[model samples]
Target: MNHLKALLIKFVMIAVVLIVVLTLIFDVPFMDSIWTSLVLTVLAYILGDFLLFRLAANRSSQNVRNMIATGGDIIIAFLTIWYMQVALVDANGSIALGSFIAAVIIGAGEWFFHKYLDGNVVSKNTRTTADLEADYKK
Candidate 1:
């Protein structure tokens, strides 16, 4: 339930950023913006939030973990938006600029979101599944 809430929050943030930059500014179709948002949100949460953020948090300070996760989120956002626009929408030359803008905005939002996750959702000292399994076997 908590994870679901976090996912929804991340989706809304990505969706709004993409819609504003891609649809309103770059004239992308509304549905394309939505599709891009959905894909980016899922990928980012799994890779950036669930995997990278948690892994980095184990070894680094809160600030360092946040920066690493945010950087990963930015890269993921940029690639996903760029691919979606170029391959699916066949967007104009402005696609790169629009994706860049949206990605930056999403990264900014993710920094704060990571903070929220740290305080309210994700624990900094979580154990990996492998560790748990190894302990159980011992």
Candidate 2:
């Protein structure tokens, strides 16, 4: 249930970000279909987390860990777009595959770079959200 709430929050955040981006780029009122998109996105995100993080977790390779995490995000995005279009939507707006791949790569790179800046501490077992907050308690 905790992860569910987190996933829903993630969906809302990503939905806002995507909607703002679409509005900026195409001047489309993306809100008309936002609720469905957000729900689909959240479900995808939770599924990805379960498959990539919870299932594929615990390995030696840091790259593998990061790959799993990144894969989760990509899966979430594609699932969101796919399910929204198929089950809940009727329009046919498309994203360029190459551009979408590039964005995923960029997002993964940015995530890794941020993790690196944080003392290369990518393992949640090593350091957690609460741990960081406690450390910063000054």
Candidate 3:
């Protein structure tokens, strides 16, 4: 239930960004933007948030964790959007450039999102008191 709520929040965040950037700016179709958002959201949450962020948080500072996860999310977004552009979206621009731009934007957003996850979404058992103290100190 907690994970589901988190996923929904993340989906909304990514979907809004993708819809605006991919559709409004890059002229991708609305449905394609939604599809890309759906794919990107799941992939990012699994690879970036669930795996990378959790592992990094256990070993690194919050800033470092955010950087690692954000970078992972950027790569995920780039590859997903790039492939979707070719196979799904019929946009009329350089797919690589558009994907890169959208990925960068998503990465920026993910940094803040990670903070939210740590506070509200991630299980407390996964975050030690020392971890919280360390994050608070910095």
Q: Is 1 or 2 the stronger prediction by lDDT?
A: 1
Best by TM-score: 1
- Between the candidate structures 1 and 2, which one is better when assessed by TM-score? 1
Tens digits of per-residue lDDT for model 2, 62-82 = 465556666666666655544
The alpha-carbon RMSD values of the candidates against the true structure, listed in the order shown, are 3.9, 9.1, 4.5
TM-score of each prediction: 0.88, 0.52, 0.84
Task: Please write out the lDDT profile of model 1 over residues 75-125, one tens digit for every residue.
Answer: 999999999999778778889999999999999999999988888787646
TM-score (C-alpha) between model 2 and the true structure: 0.52
Off by over 4 Å in 3: 57-60, 90-93, 127-138
Compared with the true structure, what per-residue lDDT tens digits does model 3 show for residues 4-123? Answer: 988898889888888888788878888998998898889999999988898775544778888888998999999998998889955456767889988998889899989888888887
Candidate number with greatest lDDT: 1
How does each model score on lDDT? 0.89, 0.48, 0.84
Clashes of 2: 0
